[model samples]
Target: MASPTLTLHQYQTAASETDRTRTTKPTRFLLLGLFGEAGTLLDEVKKKQRDSGSYVGYEANVVEELGDVLWYLAVIASRMKLALSAIARPPEQSISSYATADNEIRFSDLQQQAHLPFAAPTSNFEITLLRLVAAIGALANAQQQSLPEGDEWGPYLREIFHILIQTANEAGVTLENAANENLTKIFDRWPEERHFPPLFDEASDIAEEKLPRHLEVEIYERTVARGPGIEKLYVLQRCSGILIGDRVTDNIMEPDDYRFHDVFHYSYAAVLGWSPVLRALFRLKRKSTPKIDEGEDGARAILIEEGVSTFIFAYAKQLNFFEGQHEGDLSFTLLKRVREFVSGYEPKHCPLWLWEKAILDGYAAFRFLQRHRKGRLILDLNNRSLSIKAI
Candidate 1:
């Protein structure tokens, strides 16, 4: 006579039952849902601000929307087999402390001048979504996991959950209802596991038809640029360091210097590819032994790699790439953006010009983050923008 109470794990399993009958990829479906739901949440927040001239009147409404975002985040974590506790765990050290003195001073000044509690721009929600997506892409690369087929969504999901949890906590939203209600709604929608028509077929069709034309390398090159403080950019073959494309700020380096830097970048990429953390996270089976090449850089560099290609950014000096006080922390956000670009890249018709454009896009993304000191870069096909969050 009594109704059943669902545990988080049980809720995840029940809600995902319809996943088995669907033809769409799990990650892709989840991504679409995640983005759509996030967009909806952002839309609601924007509407409240525009209609009422402030968000104070719509606090409850915004909290409800945040719950919706959290629902999608929980489902994503469930599909990835990640525990909510793990996702909600904070890093031992925060990344903001890793900033250079100048950066720290600048951030401190911004914090002091901020009026809003979160100090984020009006479009904070949208930018947060972009950052989350970029983080997913980066985690995939660091773990050597590919999109759609990759089973290692745990780390990515954990990161998303962290963001959602932080946002909800800051807003004073209680998530218990949101989680339960979402599962109940999903179970009702799928009910008995009957097949329903695909919801995104037309969207997919349009994307397939237009993606190539819109994402042409030439078009990207024309639109994307190295914003500022970008000394050099290189697109090289993942292991070999054979140059695929490059944009230099100054004259070319000596042949020996170039080779040394190639080797250094390659080594870093290899470590990322073969990292134990990545391996364990994705459950990757080793296919071949990793090869190491000897070589060298004075300037600080960050390497973001895909299956076949790598994008290397060379900065003028050593900037802390990690988030927290730990110097070892890597810039997961930047890595994610690069991976997102690389994964969506069409290689068949790609030329040097296209590679140049892609590299420029990477530069632009890095420059934006560096300038704002707090924000995520979003690249929507040919359109590129920075989502600013107050430090």
Candidate 2:
């Protein structure tokens, strides 16, 4: 079965639905976003040029950036109260006639077009990209100059869209692919439907292999001797009166109380319902399925979770451990990096807001532990929460 064709108007309509800035400075916010995305696109291209031979994932990067660019263009058109197909009219065609023409930018069409040779050389493609950027800049210039909106505006935007289409063609990218990928990325960040995603081990036949819905982990500090006249504080955790993972210290010359960072793993399990490290610690590896046991519940997955916890701790250290930030306050760049860290893992299915909640809630519990040095970390996957109880 074929995926339904995505026409320009359909894309613009869908993209507009996800536009959070529709009410708040819609034009200005979108214009600024357009420029920022354009700069990002240019930067990706710059990296490809600079690292020509060694640059891996160049096409993927281009597709992502191009998707972003297309999204901004679609929403910007929506803001101007014009259909995307209206702005996509060819240079020689009259806008009125093209407006009603078939606006389909289908995957099959892209596949057919992708085989055709580029009309220009690689250098020309680069120049065309510059022209596209300049065209975007011209939109800002017109807005700043208080240019009147009228008949010429349609043709003006068409030219920019023309350049954009040309650039995508020369880069061997399809606008349909760009649009679809952009929708995926955006919806992954700000999903239209909000609900609890299914737990990673929800279907496990082994009851003990499932993450505990509610866990009360007692974490305390113990003093250990490193050398004569030297003592270091190590953190240890226990659940159901049985000692779990090894004792940990700050692992740095300066004591930042990172020994308490296990709270982050618990946060992942509680909020995202996926934590390989915690699963390993609690003997919850889904061994019933050999592939699941090795691939999803194995050492590499545990390392990825641990790496995410430590990486986020470092990021939070710079922000005072997200002291005053709200649930949605984590920067998109940080979330994007975290997503990249666990790109192939099960947790990658979780959305941005959930990641934010896990981080903030984990730090909330961590901050409490850092101050008190010991506490009961209460994780309720049923409630999707992490709470601290003074010990």
Candidate 3:
């Protein structure tokens, strides 16, 4: 595979190209307008229902009004140049370099054959947050891409249903599973009420225990040249921002200003199986990330530094259930070192709901174009209808 030749300088140039990227403001304003109206309308409807006390008449209206709010979210995402694909993440090489030396980038970090699945579509504010986080976290975990899996916030929901189904199957949870089964519930709350139940648990034991794919992350070390506290979060945040890129216009954190609060928090919870991970992770003192005072220089500097890996790296990978399928993606040296781990367990049937789980959590269909020779997995929604693609 031909490796993509991306440099920190390339990212700098992209961000500094004030003339190249279009301002998303006009569409953003339009989304805000829609959001305002949809919110007011929903509030009025909700109020009426509350007053009536036995409100069951306009259920369809409630759904339609909620749909309107999601439409605005789509518009805002479009304005921001964000991919409406539910799960979003940074690139692979970036994640590979950061992770412990035992990982590879895979589709949203799943071991896969990019048969995009559907997750139980969710529109609730919290579920939306979960869907987005799952995408980004999977990316952070492996720095890979997948098929569009869904749409610009409309039918895009179908993809989540596909995912939810898969997640439930993997966790050995029933389709009627409640919030008690952490990973399974992520998929079960579909086909009926799409609203995500409150989180079952802070950590996903199923993911860590059952889907423990080995990672062969390339370790790169750097001496802290600036404030460690600020630099740590800044680098993490910058990784997410530029990785997320022009997609997601509503976020004002400008990539660099964003933090890995959610990513680190979630991972630590899952990995350590403890709450202390969150407290310990953020114990680093905070400092203000400096603004590039020299015209566009600062922004350029951050973009270059932060975006450098996304363009050049590969994160996600697909796993095969049996031996003899390493396909040379594994380096002989690393494989030799970890063959003990590989030999430790026989590959088992991964449940369908667990990505292995067979449930409708999100769209299972996607166009994950893997150019292994190039170390880049280009993603496309195949919006052949919309001609929309995310590279």
Top model number, lDDT: 2
Best by TM-score: 2
lDDT of 1: 0.37
Candidate 2 vs candidate 3, lDDT winner: 2
lDDT by residue (217-321, candidate 3, tens digit) is 111112233565553212121221233212111133443212211222222122222112222222211112223122212334233323322221111112221
Mind giving the per-residue lDDT tens digits that candidate 2 earns over 50-138? 88778777787777887787888777776666666767754665666323435564433434463433232278777888888888888
Compute each candidate's TM-score over C-alphas.
Answer: 0.33, 0.86, 0.19
Ranking by TM-score: 2, 1, 3
Model 2 segments beyond 4 Å from truth?
A: 1-4, 95-121, 148-153, 221-231, 241-243
Q: Residue 133 deviation, candidate 3, in Å?
A: 18
User: Cα lDDT for residue 108, model 2?
Assistant: 38
RMSD of each: 23.5, 3.6, 28.1
